[model samples]
Target: MHLNRRHFLGTGIAASALLTAPTVWGQAKPKVVVIGGGAGGATAARYLAKDSGGAIEVTLVEANPVYTTCFFSNLYLGGFRDFESLQHNYDKLAGGGVTVINDMATGVDRAAKTVTLAGGQVLPYDRLVLSPGIDFKDGSVPGWSLDAAEKMPHAYKAGPQTQLLKKMVEEMPEGGVFAMIAPPNPYRCPPGPYERISMIAHVLKQKNPTAKIIVADPKEKFSKQALFEEGWNKHYAGMVEWIGPDFGGGKVEVRPDAMEVVIDGEVTKVDCCNVIPGQMAGKIAALAGVTDDSGWAPVDPATMKAKADENVWVLGDSSAQGDMPKSGFSANSQAKVAAMTIRGELTGSKTFPAKYSNTCWSLIAPDDGVKVGASYEPTPEKIASVESFISETGEDAALRKATYEESLGWYAGITADMFG
Candidate 1:
């Protein structure tokens, strides 16, 4: 098979052209590439694969082979739940006919409608769904970077850092202080830091009764504040202390290795510090040219289509969801809406009306739980809320316990919806 250089080059071009060409009108199916395999991307991939009925090809790109959900991660820290309970596999997505690629997306070529994988493979797409979730804004806090996270665990995204933080808390001396610095608003899992405090307090009350937990927050008010306060008073009174934006004097600065936190012009040292910084859409979103100054992608509320790029859609915490809070439940709901819209566009059918819903649950103790939620309908410009589902501040033990149980059930159901 000795061929001239010219002939070899000609053959290569022809093969490349054939591979990139769209399948025959009725014979070839449209291809969709979904980035990220968290709640939003996984759900979108599953629905697109299943509902397309072989009419659409779905490929999902994720950096990790397995996903550990942020939902219920606090329970893991409190020793109420194990890591296995939060772990999920993408086998179901593969089984559903989606090509699950265990790789990170490097970039997106919107004009050509292609996704570049970290492995240097280019996947062409008729439509692309980006759900890369949250990325911490580097230097959002001076001296806080990925390197600093090694010493002071944010545990915000969950996984190894989360476990490390739990270990640090367990090893702290009695009466030692555990300081937590919360991020600004619009971060992933808005109620997460408060839930974390409750869970850590749960562990501390048992392991080191004299140990104190301090929250140095950037915001004046927090999600489920009254409920968390009530639970703290009932179960771990005097063990938990909150320094809101005002009381903290201002935003706190973190010193990871030294385990130091500066609040209201006062410097304090702690045994452990969990500093969660402000977050934005992942880097791939920026590379795709979909993000604005806020570091989030703006999208059409009705279709989930990117405001900047028509063929691309953004979902999850990475998307500017208008009225929707950034939570796992919101991501799951948005995924379904986006999936339906993408399918309709591919099939030449009318887009369905969009509706969104979310419920974020936080546990103050093993049995004490609280939640805030909302249901929304699409308006001409954006999604608007029509109803709310929120937990009252004061609740009986039995109701709180029931809510905790319900949170577990919701986690199971939502994970099933995403990856089962």
Candidate 2:
């Protein structure tokens, strides 16, 4: 899709709705500080500012000036999209009344209700929204550390690491081996690693047909396992190999310097390796003392409010809300409910019960796209899935093409909903 300033302006205007009329404030406006500017925080910051109509002060603290979305970064690896297309700036957000600060949040004081930045600035807020995404667990993957990522890229965060992985894949030997160590359960984007494998296979099919791809997955079953397996067989048969727990995939170790992977007590030299380590909530959340021993913050399903502190809210992958996959779609859906609730609390506006929905689309090959989605409603216990749908295995090419096109539209729509 073509993007221009006018298109973004139009989309931004269309998404904006005034939730409450301009109110005369007796004192200073209620301050809202949002950390992380991905799907959840950016949408929440934008909506809170757009809907509240200057009634709430929304300051978005993000470490990066330009955000590269992890949602469609796989398409970039597959040669389906350019790296520039995956990037977005916050200029539009700044112009839309959000105070966009390009600085890292080093500390959060819950009792003081303030955030300290690496630049030595302290920001006070009446309400705080933490959507800081994920961080890798130390020593989760033996012999692999953040420093070792230079040799074996995770490419999970979708920035420099992604580019490095893509470069490595493109420059592989004609018939070299490429191995991937898939993360454990409850990681970001359940289908993400598999989608990446599909993209890598697509590239290998064109440039290096003799090349082989091996995946060591710890999970017994993954999201859309049957569909991915079917696609691998159909589009890139005999080129991909999957090792599950029954085959000792769970017992794995990697040596970045030697470029070797030990699977089930067998060492294999690989030309390239993708090591996705275990994950936890972003460090800032733990610093704020909202995250539990599980390495995720528990929140109220209805309002996305942190159960430990009502004044703080958590969203997206960092949240331990049940039944929702940790995808960009889920984060955006949760942000809307959280934004509406915050607006009501701060501006005395009308509020509605939270209803959330999400759909994740994965491209198997050129026009062969499949999807899985569900609608969710908050119960007293957790966010429960109400209804769900998925693309069938025997779907026609036309239908799969339509699914791919639908995913394209969703990409455009969601990024606009996010950055605009």
Global lDDT scores for all candidate models: 0.86, 0.93
The list of candidate 1 runs beyond 4 A from truth reads 1-27
Candidate 1: lDDT of 224? 76
lDDT of 2 by residue, 149-256 (tens): 999999999899999999999999999899999999889999999999999999999999999999998999999999999999999999999999999899999999
Per-candidate TM-score against the hidden true structure: 0.93, 0.94
Cα miss at 75, model 1 (Å)?
0.8
For candidate 1, write residues 1-420 as lDDT tens digits.
Answer: 223533664575666567755343333467899999998999999999998887898999998898999888998999999988888989988998999999989988888677888887888788999999999988776557889987888898879999999999999998999988788888988888888888999899999999998888878887777777888898898988888776862457777777788887788989998878889998899999999999999999887888999899999999986888888899899999999999998977566778899999888887787888999887777778889977887767898889889988998899999996
For model 2, the stretches where C-alpha displacement exceeds 4 angstroms are 1-27
Question: Model 2 reaches what TM-score against the true structure?
Answer: 0.94
